[model samples]
Target: MSTTTTTTTKQGHPPGLYLLFATEMWERFSYYGMRAIFVLYLTQALLLDKNVATDDYYGSYTGLVYLTPLIGGYVSDRYWGNRRSILVGGLIMALGQLLMFISASFYQNFSVSHNVMLLGLLALIVGNGFFKPNISTMVGQLYPEGDSRRDSAYTIFYMGINLGAFFSPIICGFLGDTGNPADFRWGFLAACAGMVVSIITFELLKNKYLITPEGGAIGGTPEKVAQIEDNTPKRSISENIGWAIGALVLAVAFFYGANIDLIGSFIFSLSIIAPLYIILDKSLNREEKERISVIYIAAFFVIAFWAAFEQAGTSLTFFADEQTDRVVFGKEIPASAFNSINAIFIVLLAPIISIIWVQLAKKGLEPASPAKQAFGLLFLSIGYLVIAFGVKDLNPNVKVSIMWLTSLYFLHTIGELCLSPISLSMVNKLAPPRFAALLMGVWFLSTAAANKLSGTLGALYPDEKLIAAGKIPSIFGFQITNLYEFFMVFVVFAGVASLCLFLLSFRMKKMMHGRG
Candidate 1:
């Protein structure tokens, strides 16, 4: 069996890291730019109801976006490989963006526009499935096993992701989210251009830079490499099929019992099933299974974190639009631009956070990955708590100071710094080489569930019209009559999840077998 090797660099990291960084930056720019205006375009241009747009359309779209990575990962592991999958996915996404531009151009004809937009979204979801996991998995391959710089490298890569995210909303929102609906096409066009840049950048540079230390090309087709054989006894095909069938039945039951829509139920079901399938692989020994278990456990906790954090795209965006004071130096800021705050904070703070991790590492005092993630959930809860208090006792018609929303974003950025990149690095460190991309896809599966839940929670946003009609929104038996109660819901979810993960961190650290 052969394994990938890492190159030494005077800058403390390989040059390939920077190449991947620039590639991912533009990809994120395309993704976040389109996302910044998706809901606004649906509601304002297509004139869909808020709840319908968020719960049915946006939830389903984003959920599927994450869900299909399972298929992409499997295909990559068996056939396409990372480089080919990324190129194909990028081209597809670029086409998706062009379709969106056309959809926005035809916004006046709702039926035509809606159908075309759906097709475009389908393209984006499928493309992202191929693109997301492969790129992330490649980042881990850039370093050898147990390298101290791995975590810091991921943090730096995360900053690249945010750099793109930070500018996208400002540019996209400025072009598309102006009061007039006709301008949405310009935003989609810009996103299309970003995707094109991403594709070209990767294609031009990958052969030169995406290589192992010995100058062997990385992420080549799986068949081209000599692989370690998994000789452990495996489940019979019939038995495996039986398990899959059982999982599907449970998914349907959940759909009906939980009253979540089809997409939500599907995402939630696969989030569990996919991880279980990987764990059941007969090739994994006791230690490998335990380490993988930690990934699954942390992923479960992450669902809670992102369900709250992702409100930035839906409920939080609504709050910024309707409730926050957006006036700045005598001009009103576009609500969609508020999406940039978290990303901008990430760009500013990621370096400091990266430095802290390195400094702590040198002294053998760095917190374990699980402990760091718990702190992330804690900060997320605190962020919501701050906004909950700000919204307390306020009249529905009266706008609160923008500072409240900014504070929430600032805190959430800290939480994101703690959790998101760490989880990515954790998956990379803990995953076996053969299962690398597949496990990355499983990690994203949790995000699929969270994004769906975010939409479900976003639907619970207290609409003033609904409140006036004497119909208050509720979740898990708690009534949300106002913005304060709504915000508190997240506070409770994240706080409880943080506590639970904290208690489990000690055990999970032991499971890692000293890897962290």
Candidate 2:
């Protein structure tokens, strides 16, 4: 029973590892930069109205963004090889970013032209489908299987993501929304520039990192002579044609999700899940089935967590806008600015937490996997409670200060630090090697599903406002007219899910059969 682990001594592996880090850093700068403004632009600048269309837009955008990584991951693992796939994905995404800039420009001219916006959105969704998975896969390939540093590597990688997200809102939000079109142009340009910067850095370092993964390029310009996997599936023309139709049909279904309600959304999600489930069920062995079962179960708990957690972008943002007082030392800040708090917290706390996890793991005092996840959920739930307390304290005429919101964000960030990245690493490690990337895809599919639900939950609160504030719709027959009431329900949901996971951990561990 040899259990030898791979090690990447500080000087070991290629110097290019850090280059990829830098590349990823800039790409995040582009992504979060755009994300910070996308919603604001839609509601405020473009005036699309916030109720149904807004959540749909967010759900569709974020869900599809996550879902495409499956296609990207499979293309890399089975056909393109990681490096080539990464390059292709990066270039595609870069083009998409420029297209998005064009979109903003068109928006400036046409204001509410749906066609331009749709095209830009399509470009981004498609481009992200290619980029996200490939880049993460590249990071994993930088180390051997079971590498001790892999967790740290991902932490570092995640940090790169957060650091960019942390700054993008501050900079892009400032520039893009700086009371003039000139500032907006600079913001969009900064996004495009950051992506290009990342792409160039990636290209330079591609060769060095290729030292171990040892595969030739697979995708770039259509002209380049690149190698494909020798056994890349040679589907018959009829089968390929059938798949094309199936994909089109599936795309149509999800595209409709942009306009439909929970029923339509659920139908679309089930369309993806049902077929995949039947295939996995019918094809895999007992052990494999059980392993995937854990993954799926984990998926549900994740949905529970994300439904609560994702309120940060939607419901929480709205709360900050209407209810929470934004007086930071007597000067008011925009509600959207609070959205940056979680990323900022991550940038500051991630390294310290990562080090603690590593040290604890080495000492055998690290909490078991399920417990950690449960802990994350607990914090998230508690965070909502913390905010609710602030609401309780405010006088009829007086408002709570920004510090309370920041405090709540700190708790949610702690929960996120515990749950999110840990889950990614867990998926990569626990999945059977043969189906590694696909399992990762399934993992992200969970994210896709969870995100869609997150949007719905944003709309799911009570109208505590009309009853409590003015004429506003309740999310779930409850008057969300009050920010505290809306957020508290989600927080409570997360806490309950955490407790359930905690109680079930021992049973789940038994089923894991030591695989975890």
Candidate 3:
């Protein structure tokens, strides 16, 4: 492997970090702004059933969103450089937002608007695939190998993400959630503006700021892959054809999941198959295979963590809208405003947690990445338990205090702090440099599966049937009529996954080959 000498920069971080930060912040603003009202739009604007909206459309859209990153990362690594991919992705996403604005503007024409919304989602999904992984890969490239600043840089970057997230709902929700149901186009237009800002920031500053202290640009595609080609045999045409066919089949299945009842099972099946395909590939050496094994193991745990965590955008949003009391000081706040709480907590806590990691590392007390992720799952489980308790035996006619939902988001935010950034860094560190973006995309497979699971689980949220009549529903003989019963499913799922991951941490760490 060719090694680059470490160059010093101010504050132990390069200036490129801030540029990427601003770029990601604005991108996130555009994304979360759209997400904040997506479910509400499905239900109110599109006039879909709430249960179906969350279960099918929301689940399928989100699952596909994460799924496209695999293609984006591969194309960027093999054809487009990171910078070009990011620019193209940002522009596409901006266009997507514009399409969504048109969708909202044409809300009265249900057919035209619905088709437009689908097109917008496709654009956003394709664009995000290109933008998300490459930018994060660029952040890792900014620091040389073995630099401690990488984690802190990501935390700071994460804060940028949340800062955008923190404000998006307030801005977009306020504009979108006007008492008039037909005015959502304003919110989507605001999202489009955010995307424009993101692209402009990236374009204007990349050459000036996206470089090492030594003044060489970073994240351009390398001319040759020195490390990966060694001892790897090239695939034959038939083998390549087979792989293409397989990918086509997976794509067909994913699209079918929108209307099919069996998508959850298909996603779970793909979760296993996708990692195995990577691990068993002859192109990878033993070291790469072993390192990827850690990602695969981590991916399983990822499924559980995100399946619960992602409730924020769907089921939890509904809960906030339907069950949670949003009144404070004689004012009824919009339920969608609660979507910002997780971001607010992330913004508030990211710096604190970054410092904690630094201090712990100085004392040689920092937990291994796997152990930290286990803690994340544990916290996720605890968050569910909190809400489960808060809503136990609650009346349907009266709304529960908003604190229940707020507290849940707070706990989930801490769990996210422990898991998300660590996992991102881990993938970059472990992946073969040649396939860094591809592996990052692979890492998102867990999220794709988890989102599908989340949608399926969201289908189980207290339906009007249960809420109105206080009837208990059963899943595999376990009764879940009340809010407590419904949430306990996540408590058990996350709690058990946390325990399993905790047990596997030592072994997974060993498989990491000292990369940590």
Candidate 4:
């Protein structure tokens, strides 16, 4: 390959879309499989002190998961190509799954030994970091600007993600929740199957349908590649070793129990993406900076939306498992299956949402990006309020019905429809062409921040003791108890955020000029 192909599927994209489709499908399955059990394992299996407030740990863990893509994206953009990084990540993740499998099998055998499982989780984190960002970038590579299929392509891609989520809980849950979920290695094995399927699917499609002929993996003959290398910038061997050593140290720290916060601490510390743009401004004119400025504003609003919505993995999941009765057809459902409800809703509604966007845009009535996001926050605020009201006045002797949780997911799904996909399009539209991928990275960083905060916010939920411990004491004039008071904090916070965002619409739109 002289110059690696970048795709631009205009009217109809290539069949390679299916390749990414299947690959992402399984990858998400594995991810959801692991996720399905993460909180459950922590609260029920590992028996950590859930009441002691583990939100920081969970927030840091999930946050870091999103954050690592920055490192992975940078590596792919600067040194290795997307294809190689994806392959490496897949293999490493497979091993991590194997480690998890071993950990489960031997949980009682090792009993107190945390090293065996901790190391495996660390590997998965690094592997996922390497894999996630690069793959998304490849999807963009498959279609150029103005490709009619591009937006539809992404919507379809998201569908693949949900497809995995849809099946994972049912399939893995059946295996995992058997007699005892805590020590079941079968769940880990199911997750491993997902990674393997993803790796194999992508590997086969790398040369065929997935990539076009502009910028992609480089595997040219020695004579062609060798000549270009002589003029390339060179770094000393010691510098290379220093970088390697740093990466190794990070890996070590990641494996430790609590130090895993190092991921969130480090990634959160990188919220200064603006400085990088400032430095590059010497090469850019006035128009580019204004364009990039819009991206940052949108990125900020999205962080708030995701932070609230992502509670599905943290607080909401906890509520489902602990406070709500998840019986369906007279049998109790695994709490994680509730997690899939969003994906299932997305799978069913994404096409309809896409159609609505098209019709709205055609009629010159498309909502401003800021408005869409603000409305999304409003949807989330309402979702939380629904739960707040639904769970109120419970007699303290019984669990709430599953219907309340289901309704909450439905509202969150609506908010998700408004915010998530639209934001992706908005960011791509607002970013200047040259820094497209970098700005996308920034957008992903915002998601990382919100997801991280999702974990942090989770700690606010009232555990059994928190209620019984009288933490919800009546303050002066008001009385609040159980999860109701805790959720009210978010309800008010989100409602205010939505209002502020709505008011900011005119200013935010002006920042975008005519971009979207």
Candidate 5:
């Protein structure tokens, strides 16, 4: 396994890190830009029911976005390798964003616009699968084993993600939400422009900046690309044909779900199967299996953390749009602008948190990765609790102050600092070399499940049915009704999960077999 360059010229870090940083930054700009507007476009522009948008379309789109990475990661690991996968994926995604722009250009044609939107979404989903997991893998590949900087490197990388996220909503929302319903397509067009910038930036700088200390290109296949192959394959051409047909069938199923329904089920099944397929590979040594077990355990906790955290694009967006008072200086602020709050906080806090981790490590006081993750969940729960309390006496006809949501985002950003980047570093460190990108995809599978679950939970946002029935929806005995009640559910759910994870941390660290 050729992991790192042998050459050593120590200053701060390698150039490849910043190159990937810039690439991922623009990619996130495109992604988060689209996300900032998607639900609003569905509910406000298309005039779909809010419940359907959250429960079905939003859930399916985000879920499939993560699900396809399983295919992309596997194919990259087996054949395409990371650089080629990213190049191809970037092109496809840029085209996908263009298709979305076309969808918006035909905004007046209801049937045609909707069909084009579906096609655009399909392209984005396919493109992202190839782009998301592989790029993160390249980051880890730049560093050698047991390097302390890996964690901070990912944190720095995460800031690049937030840097793009912070500006995108401001730009995209300004263009799309210009107080005119017809102008919403402009946001999608802006997203297309972001994708174009992302790929072009990558292509221009990758050769110069994306290299190790020894000047070795990262993400390229170690051997000739044509020689890439699976460890074992059936010699029969019919078997290969049969597998190709199966892939086509799966894609068709995704298309049907994208068009009509049942995407959640497909994603749930794939989430289980993809990781299991990796873990059961006969080539993994005993230590690798144990390390993988740790990833699964951590992923379970991550699902809990993200299920609540990911609501920024779903429930929180709805809250900001419909329930939060956006008046500042007597002018109403755009709801999508609120999405940038989390990113803004991340931009401000990430470097501070990165420094804190290093300082703590120097003093031998830094928490283990699992413990840090538990703390992340704890902060997430506290964030929800803070908002839940503020909304306890809220009037239905009136909106709460923006401070409440801003404060919630602040806490969530702190929690993210602890959990999200750490989890990425954990996967990078623990996964076997051959399975690197594939395991990264599996790590994202946790987020896929969380994204879908967040959407499902978003559906429980005290809609007409629950309000009309005069009964709050109770899950695990927590009643949910108004903004306060709905928010309380997450408080209890994440709080309990965080506590459980904290209890399990000691055992989990032991299971890491000195890796932690």
Candidate 6:
């Protein structure tokens, strides 16, 4: 119940920040390492059709991964609390990675391997629901209210995420993506090991460092919820259940009407309904409603950004594997290894961006969070534009320079620097303390929608085989005959979304009151 600020070091941040950093780093290592090779495993080892692999399985798995965070966030807010949720989630994810290792190990036995892989994906999706939101919410708790350092702290935390991501592809790709199906188990096993390390680190450190500035434990059980009085009217348990059932019915109706697959429908529907449910709560005042509306609005725009950015694991990997000139110094780079490029760029640039934000704050020149995200979308569009031009007029059979793809990732990294961490900090700043973890989950819900769309777009990757089969690839009725057009799809989506968000940024900032 103490109101004192948490202790800090010479670095101007709490020591617990590093602890959470290490924990999140290893979890991302586990997740990204497995992801770096998942598509390849489906296409090469399992010999599934590329479209089916990306559009159905890969998209569903990744989308569901983000979707389940809603459940985890709600559970943490209502019952388990952040620390316990993280531990449980980390353990399940480790098991999921271990199952993936088994799945890769049994690749020769197609049925067993495929079934086990599905089970593994399920575990990971559920586990991530618990782990992802809680960890992010805790980052904000490390600082007291009105702390200007929060944004910089998130940027530093984001660096840890990228640091793990940077290494995962290199290490996992080296071990598993060596053109031999039998070797993938080693990469998955490495991911499993990373998850185990993450769990152990959190268990050892949470009590010691993961605390509020006032020396109170952060993310404790519901019994230890913050002592701040709530004047808002509380909903009855029956009313909450009624809302849940109503949302489920609406989601099912959307699934049938949307013509997309079941998982996609569920993700997209919940992304909309979940936030509406929160906003409609009778307990929220006018100010809280406006702030939450800003979160929802930003989340809507974020969908477009992630839908385009997430292609790294799908269509982009295909480009690297088949169209890019990967040979260098007499060795061929694994397609999965290219996934590390964005991560490496983030590692190199996060500190600089962090400094830039801090300096801008000092001068009172800092853009509102929404404006930063608008610039993010702009950078993303430009990244795609760069690659679109790079591939224009190039022969289908001829590989382009690796520099083209490298340049695209560089711009996307800048876009991510602008948006992702800023959004996290914004949610932390704007969310009611009682709803902190749940609101973070709501933010990730946008990512779930984006990832699902990423898979759908990835399926449109203009494969020659599909074209030869008379199945022309298109999005919204426009044909994608080659890489040029495919890349432009992203350019247009991000560009339009960026311009629109920029125009609305001022209004959204006003909704934040003085918090902006």
Clashing pairs in 6: 5-213, 6-213
Relative to the true structure, candidate 1 reaches a TM of: 0.96
Task: Please rank every candidate by lDDT, starting with the best.
Answer: 6, 1, 3, 5, 4, 2
Candidate 6, residue 502: the lDDT equals 91
Q: What residue runs in model 1 are displaced by over 4 Å at the alpha carbon?
A: 1-7, 224-226, 229-236
Question: What's the lDDT for all of these models?
Answer: 0.89, 0.67, 0.85, 0.71, 0.83, 0.91
Candidate 5 per-residue lDDT, tens place, 1-516, comes to 334344342336777788888888888888888888888888777787776888787887887888778788988987788888998898888888888778777777879878988998899999999999999998987776776678878998998999999999988888886666677788888888888888888888887877655567877764543342355332367755654565456645655765424676566666666676677766677888989988988898888898899888888998998889999999988898888999999999998988898899889998888999999999999999999998888877788889999999999999999999989998898888877888888888888888888888887787655468685555667666678888988898899999998899888888788777
On residues 10-68, what C-alpha lDDT tens digit does candidate 6 reach at each position?
24898899999999999999989999999999999999999999989889999999999
lDDT of each residue in 1-516, candidate 1, tens digit only? 123332243247877888889889999999899988888998899988788888898888887888888878888987889999999899999999999999999999988898899999999999999999999989878776676778888998998899899898899999999989999999999999999999999999999989865677888898642245334465789988987887798799888997768878788888878888889887888999999999999999999998899888888888999999999999999898998999999999999888898789889889999999999999999999999999999999899999999999999999999999999999999987778888989988888888898888899999988788888789779898988899999999999999999999999999999886
Candidate 4 regions exceeding 4 Å error are 1-10, 51-53, 109-113, 179-183, 213-264, 273-281, 432-434, 466-481
TM-score of each: 0.96, 0.83, 0.93, 0.84, 0.91, 0.96
Candidates 1 and 2 compared: the better one by lDDT is: 1
Model 3 weakest lDDT span, ten residues long: 1-10
Model 4, span 266-338: residue lDDT tens: 5555544422433254545576677677667766777788888877877787788778887778888887778
Candidate 4 or 1, higher lDDT: 1
lDDT of 2 at 11: 37
Candidate 2: worst-modelled 10 consecutive residues by lDDT:
218-227
Task: List RMSD in Å for every model shown.
Answer: 2.3, 5.0, 3.1, 5.7, 4.0, 2.0
Which ten contiguous residues of candidate 1 have the minimum total lDDT? 1-10
Model 6: residue 384 alpha-carbon error in angstroms: 0.6
Query: Could you give candidate 3's per-residue lDDT for residues 113-204 as a string of tens digits?
Result: 99999999999989999998899899988876777677788888888999999999889899997766687888899999999999999999
Q: List the residue pairs that clash in candidate 4.
A: 5-212, 5-213, 5-214, 6-214, 6-215, 16-209
The residue ranges of model 5 lying beyond 4 angstroms of the native Cα positions read 1-9, 222-261, 464-466, 469-479
The all-Cα superposition gives candidate 4 an RMSD in Å to the true structure of 5.7
User: Which lDDT tens digits does candidate 2 get at residues 378-457?
Assistant: 99888889888888645445666677789989998898888877776766666654455556766776677777777767
